[model samples]
Target: MPNYSEKPTIIFDMDGTLLDLAYDDFIWNELLPIRYAEQHQCSLEQSKQTLFSFYQQHNHTLKWYSSRFWTSQVGVDVLAMQIEQKAKVAKREGCIELLTYLKENGYPIWLATNADYAGLQFKLEETGLRDFFDVIVSSETLGHAKEFIEFWQILASKHPFDAKNCYFIDDTEKVLNGAKLFGIEQLYSIQQPSSAKAPRETCNYPMLSALTDLIPILEAQTTEQAEEQKKYA
Candidate 1:
């Protein structure tokens, strides 16, 4: 069972959580490397290694801001071009419906992601899902990934939802652990097709294989809340 004392504000993660982001894997692993190799006169394997090394070394750096990775590696304006390219390759699944249901029922849905704005915008536009969120927050805006407990505190100060009455759903176990550390009442680790096994400390809360599974519970909760509000009125 989901462990919330009452209906709480829902925070969602984008990318591989609410949206299937296999497109990114394909781009990074295949398309980007091939393009770089073709443009730079290097072996495809060497091109892949170069880009992977940069990402591995600077995964959290704001180097993405300058689009240097694209310039230095692929010799093209990847930030702009990747928008349409990723859309062509991306796919939406059941989670899209769940997000729509949550919005229709008036849940205060906030999106928390570690993605850069351009990347986040691409995914949302590709999936035609920009309107599902009340606000889409990137850790870039927060100045850190959600893995930092401090980032959650900053979010609480700005958003002011109850920690004991909040539902944080994310596919990354590292971010989930950060939520748990900050005393979020319910932490859910989603199982996307691309996600790996639950990392350590995942036993602290429930596991959901798909966002669709939460639809019934949320619908019931919404109905109950409406009925209670009517009675009080």
Candidate 2:
């Protein structure tokens, strides 16, 4: 449990942390390939193979998350596709309750993600999650992916938060490892980022099956903070 007298900043990863990742998976794996196949007049299998090859080549690079870059490479309107698939976007179970609790408690929450700004905007609009965050940071804005150390350095320089006090929850181990290497004290991983997928193997850090799991811990922390304030008073 995290109990901070100073009210630590809560940094959340957007895709798998707050929102369901099924939409992203569908967009990249199914929808994009379908559109690409249609555009190039190829079989679905051929389009998937070619697109996946491109994905493998650019896996960890900034290009992987760039809508503009993919639009040029894939010769299709990537953002338009995202907008078209916006109906599939949704918040993870218990995420809304968790966000409401954090907001009511006055925790300064920030959304940090590797999603391109356009995709991020579309998801935010579809899910209505934009207003819940105090600040939103995207890798596209910094020109680096979350897996790199420089991303954290740039984020710290721009946002300025105590690494030890901040709680960063992300679904990807690589991203969590990046934050840990950058000296973030508290880290959490999501067991099932996509509800359609089975739960993943246990990670090095603590795992959350759902955001609501932390409510009890957070409520306890709130009680502790109140008691401490009373002691001082």
lDDT of 1 by residue, 57-174 (tens): 7664445433435566558566765664764544336776787777776677888988777677767776777787777787777776788788899888887888876788887777
Q: Which stretches of candidate 1 lie over 4 Å from their true place?
A: 1-6, 60-76, 89-91, 195-205, 216-233
lDDT tens per residue, model 2, 1-233: 33446777899998888889998999999899999999999999999999989999999889999999999999999988888878888899999999998899898989999999888887888888888999899999997899988999999999899997788899988998999999997888998999889998878989898798877766676688888777666
TM-score, one value per model: 0.78, 0.92
The residue pairs found clashing in candidate 2 are none
Q: What TM-score would candidate 2 get against the native?
A: 0.92
**Considering every candidate listed, which one attains the maximal TM-score?**
2
